[model samples]
Target: MEDGKLTVRAVERALDILLCFTDSSDLSLTEIASRVSLHKSTVHRLLASLEGKGFVIRDASSDKYRLGFRIWELSANMTHSDDPALILLPEMERLRDQLDETISLYVSDGLERVRVQAVQSNQAIRRVAPIGARMPLHVGASSKILVAFAEPEVQQSLLASPAWPAGLDKASFRQQLAEAKSLGFATSVEEREPGAAAVAVPILNRAHRLVAALAVSGPSNRLTLEKMMEHAPVLMEAARRMGKMIK
Candidate 1:
């Protein structure tokens, strides 16, 4: 492939626009310009070119533009296919049943944690979050464990963000992350979502790198903070045992 100089400004604005699509469904020209810190006309021109190239689509009714389905198609093809989801689901189910709570497995995706597998408890009252849900690293027990065990670069990127989006303040998040790493387990009390509490521990490979996080979650009333701490050891052991069995 031949290499040539690309317009840095154009490239930067394009990335800014693309990043805006992560959490937002649709954005107007003004909103995109403000978020990207580019002039309205400049953003409009870029959006027009991107739309022509099938990378961005405009909603006529709302007069807003967003990432096109082309991005989804590309991303779906790029997701991990060799991970332990298939090999670990049954074990996760057993753990969930034994504990009478939800068990989930997550892996680091950049600074975020993505749920790859889950097993819901048979209890009538249980929390159920599906697979493929991406969560903030600072919030839930599973996500925090993933962040605590991540490589230094991954942790640094999350900490360096201007606004931590997991409903956690920077200082509090840092404190929890440090404690979790030292303790080899993570517990959260109503941090990720309302009325939910969880405990999790990292699954490490033979090389001591994090492969996944094993977590149990339930309603805050049923899974009190005290009970979560008590159950931490159980979850930690399960994660370790599964890690050894898996890749």
Candidate 2:
């Protein structure tokens, strides 16, 4: 067989070994080799590779292997909304206290944006993006910011989607998304709710992937264009701090 074909066959066998643990978490080297119909020597080498990369660990006493911390970490982050909110809430509060405005953190759920964390302003009339609030991705500063910072394939699929607001101009929306990304922030005045204004920035992960949108919103009279622009830098910085805190 060609070297490339041998490599592919080896990978397939390695993956088969991994799948054996799906139904059972722990297995001996002999047991795994039997399950995958592979020789003991090849199975041992594959298990060593998996263990070296922290995908699996072999117990010296029991002579059995089980999944490792890397697998747990990946599973935990599969639901991005959970652990990240816990880490980001404190930073959101700090930004709210610093700016004296409503703070919100939203993550994309398919074509909709879900508010996972928020700190409402104590003022008499403030815009409230309540926790668990779900909004379409085609409108609002936070929504636009989330979609704009989304992965390229995701952004293209979302933009080409037909669920956008009626009479929405795709070209202008694309231009606005580009501007928002270039400027590192996005703003909307009375777009989502009447008498409401907001400025949003992207909350990214360690890989620089957009996980959420951090926004400060308030009554239009108080959060005017100039104020949102002035506070954009602060919001951007807060998002950066929150991203660093995400494990």
Local accuracy by lDDT, each model? 0.83, 0.86
Segments in model 1 whose C-alpha atoms lie over 4 Å from true places? 1-82, 165-168
Error of 1 at 162 (Å): 2.9
lDDT for residue 231 in candidate 2, whole number 0-100: 98
Candidate 2 segments whose C-alpha is farther than 4 A from its true place = 1-82
lDDT of 1 by residue, 162-185 (tens): 656665578887888899999998
RMSD of each: 5.8, 12.7
Per-residue lDDT over 143-245 for candidate 2, one digit per residue giving the tens place of the 0 to 100 score: 8899889988767877778776668888988998999889999999988778989999998878898888999999999999999999999998888888887
lDDT of 1 at 149: 82
Which residue pairs does candidate 2 place in steric collision? none
lDDT of 2 at 230: 95
